[model samples]
Target: MTSNFRSLPVIALLTILSLPLVVMYAFTLVDSITDAEPGSLIPSEFTFHHWRFLWDDTTGRGSVWIATINTFIFAGSTAAIVCATSLTSAYALSRLNFPARRFFLAGVIILHAFPTITLIIAIFLILQFLGLFDTLIGVIMVKAALELPFGIWVMKGFYDTVPWEIEMAGVQDGASRFMVWRKLVLPQVQPGLSALLIFSFLSGWSEFILPLVLAPGSDAQVLSTYLAYFLLDDSLEVDFNLFKSVGLFYALPVILIYLAFQKKLMNIYGGGSKG
Candidate 1:
């Protein structure tokens, strides 16, 4: 009871600090569903008019559902690829003793340090040369490739936490290296893997520039790019309420993902510090 009492001040401080963000989000929600008088900040009437984009194809870039589907595919594919490649690569990096292993690890960190924007022109030219411009697969591949360094580094940290005895036991029992890794090492680092998957998915989902620059077609559009269209329209009268609704819609998945995997996400730091 005393501990709980002592924590109240910290909680109160946090709540006070968060009040503005809470109020802003509340106003955004209310504004999306309610209309204000011409000159008033207060909502005057309740309506679903701003959410009409959910049913109507008014954006002229195709249905928001198309963008949503493309986003899911792009994010899902990147997560899967990052997970698959990182698992094996990190395992090798953690357990194997090959020449220049330290140098390779250093190179991985260097690659991740470079901002994605700096390489956009080169990536754009390469995609065009490969005839993959304006395609979802092209963007997915690029996102996965870019995400690999971080994924590998994180997974390696987790793998380093695993005991060698467990692997040796499996090997002594006549299990192949693949079987040992698949059954033993993988389970121990499940938290890191889960965290990486969520991180990669969120990274891909929130990505705006790559899709905007490399895959500009309506069919390859993701939610982030779709949201930009609201302001890109040449009309002088922009519907701010509609923009808020679209922003909320775009954010809903990320919010849900965080709520669901928040615990695993915390484990990322725990695993990283182990190595």
Candidate 2:
């Protein structure tokens, strides 16, 4: 009786915490199917009008498809670049013997602290000089830069956590440094890679400011800009339901990626044997 009674407070606290989430989810579930009015908690008439209207591109103006593709290109490119660069750079930082290594790591730290948004104009100028402004490559470059430090830091720690003996054994077995790294180091650090990959994906997938500034052209506009268009139509504006649908579509890909990676993250972090 005493032990069970001790659990009461925990159960009570949990109920209190869950109340708000339950309410919010209940509201969201209802709103998703309804012609939900602005500033209303509950819809007066439940309907799927918003969902249908979202696909009504008979007017040839739905930016959903455009935004989706742009987001994929941006997120995919950033992930690939960040992963490739961070992997090589981190391996060096962890194992290489060189002067100014600490200084270089410090430089990476300082670079992370500097907000990319603060360098918009300077980046624009440089991009313009390099003929990259208003281009997907320009946005990709900026996003990659922003994601680099964290990726490097995370991968470096991962490499550091690995046992040196694994590499040593491989080396004694007549393996080259590159060969041992390719076979042993990479396999051990995969979870850390998963962790970094998810973070890198998130970094650029939802990025709005850099892409907005860099890709101002209609051809280059992404999901963030696409949403901004809906916001600009004040007189002919749609309701919150439409906006939510916009969010739903933009979020679907990232959600899918997260779901796919979430299990991997758990497996990695849970101390499951390395694949």
In order, the Cα lDDT scores of the candidates are 0.92, 0.79
Model 1 Cα lDDT, one tens digit per residue, 90-179: 999999999999998999999999999999999999999999999999999999999999999999999999989989999999999999
Note each model's CA RMSD in angstroms.
2.1, 3.4
TM-score of every candidate relative to the true structure: 0.94, 0.85
| Model 2 spans > 4 angstroms off | 1-8, 14-22, 36-41, 52-54, 58-62, 233-235, 266-275
Worst lDDT 10-window in candidate 2: 266-275
- Could you tally the backbone clashes for each prediction? 0, 0
Predicted structure 1, TM vs. truth: 0.94
